[model samples]
Target: MYRAIKYKIPVVTAWSAPGTALLVTLFPDISLNEAVAAYITSAVVIFFIGITGYFDKLLSWIPQEVAAGMMAGILLQFGLGLFTATDTMPYIVFGMLAVFLLAKRFSPRYAMVWVLIAGVVLSMLLGKINPVTADFSLAIPQFIAPEWTWSSTLNLALPLILVSLSGQFLPGMAIIKLSGYDMPAKPIISATSIASLAVACVGGITIVLASITAALCLGKDAHELKEKRYIAGVANGLFYILGGLFAGSIVMLFSLMPKELIAALAGLALLGAIATNISVAMGKESQRDAALITFLATASGMHFLGLSSVFWGICIGLVAHFLLSQKNRNAVPVTASDSKRV
Candidate 1:
């Protein structure tokens, strides 16, 4: 429906985040059926909730860079996890890295497209793709029959809402701002939430607005230079529907792709985003220590008090920052240029 999608760039960009999830879930022994279901459910909920004025105010409060960093932090583990399984497909990783770096340095606008193209070319040349044995079945949309069990609701639904809110939605706001695009955050949020709800009803995982990778779409480096890039979102929605329908086929195709490919491509895809976030997060001397602590704690994989380390880490870092600031404040002279005795 959106005009930008005609070029297929936005669709590719949109598909990156969910597509990776799809690949990981369907290919490996473990399937993220619940996560996927949650993602879709979340998307729908966000979409509807976005129609409110509250979301507009909320978006204005959060800083864009912080949101981007938060997104990168959320996906850090997923990207790093690729390296662990890259041994089986070294070329995929190498190709992804090579093209990614080249694109970033040379043509930021088309980096993702090039990386994807390179990945495909390298995979074909390396004889890594197994098209012959891949399955081509379609997956009919299956509705999730919600059973009201305390554990299921609390452990799954509640946490998902929180994570999507704090971890996903807030950060998405930051990203929208960071890219210098003052688009209506509420509508987008509501749209994504509603999309999530739709997916959840159909046995899909929740998908909140993607703050981290959304930059890939919004950034100057991702899409081909054009005025109608919004079509990319439309393309993304189409791919989502297609992937949902041909989920079996898509999964089978991804299964044949190398692990290194997934990892390298993911990491490569996120490089620009990561650099921008780190730059902004560390730019201010006041927030540097706190932000770094937040980054490390999130990256550390440590958990305590029934909370993810990322959330706790930011909380702890914020407290430390505030306390340390008080000490510094007490020592500073009340007036500027106070060389004379008061």
Candidate 2:
């Protein structure tokens, strides 16, 4: 959701997806099953809602290259953050970077292949992986029995809608707009709302268009062939299906893989996406400073009021974008075109 909200890329979206799992670790009271359940629910919601195909329209808003560049910029810290946490991660970092850079330069279709190979090799060499512990539990849906509590629905659904608009839809539009798109916002937000409700029915938390991470897929830096961008959603959806089916096993496999490896692989995988976000965000004279600040702040790991840096960074970026835009209002008459830029 980061890219859709900000200007991050897709691989970074995958990396960020796993971040939800981090909550499980941090909150010892929450089981891995519960944490993953939320994600799975969100995926199902996203998939069904995506049937409308509105996202395709969003493609026109932003230039593919600029989107890709901004994506890479947004996720710059994730893959590298592994090294700070552990020594073994650096190896994965190297392998990930090597393959990712190679893919960007030569064959983007095989970028994920490089990451998988590196993960396998590194896990074997480092003794971080184990097939034995892999669990095979299917994630059966658990419906959250609805209670027509007006207070609850308003409190829950309203905020979710608002966040999806400001947090997810706005940035999603931004990614496309930054890339050079000019699609309508109503349909996109409407799709997200429908998706959120669907997922909520299946016990999902909130499923919005991923602004921050979707950029990874939409950006050119994601693959050597520019068209490979869509592969992100395809890959993510496939993984989501597989992940939901084998949630237990997936969790175990990741658990066996050292944290450092996961972090590095994630960071490396996101390199292209981050680079794209940064480049595009910097391209505009008016938005450059604010975008950079947002990029740095989001990448900085800072948090406030239980929200991640991504959330706070967007808030700061929006404020900056608004302030800067207003300041330039007299110097440069604001037009409908300029209004649509953010």
Q: Which candidate's TM-score is highest?
A: 1
Best by lDDT: 1
User: Each model's TM-score?
Assistant: 0.74, 0.65
Clashing pairs counted in every model = 35, 50
Residue-wise lDDT of candidate 2 within 1-342, one digit each (tens)?
322333223322222232333343345654334444444444444444445565455434333333333344346667557457456456665666676677757876566677777767867886666657445778787765544444333333333333343345545666655644454554554545455556655655555556555655665645555434555656676777787788767777777767766676666556555555666677777667677767776667664654555556666765676677678886856799989996
For model 1, the stretches where C-alpha displacement exceeds 4 angstroms are 1-68, 75-91, 102-108, 124-127, 133-138, 223-229, 320-337, 340-342
Candidate 1 lDDT, 1-342, residue by residue in tens: 332344333322222243333335334532345445445544545555677666677655444334444555665775676566567777677667777778778986677789888888888898887657666677776655554444444445555555556555566666656655555656555555555565555654565666555666665554445345566566566777788778888887788777667777777667666777778777877666666766677667665654455556556655656676677778865665565544
What lDDT does each candidate get? 0.60, 0.55
Give the Cα-based TM-score of candidate 1 against the true structure. Answer: 0.74
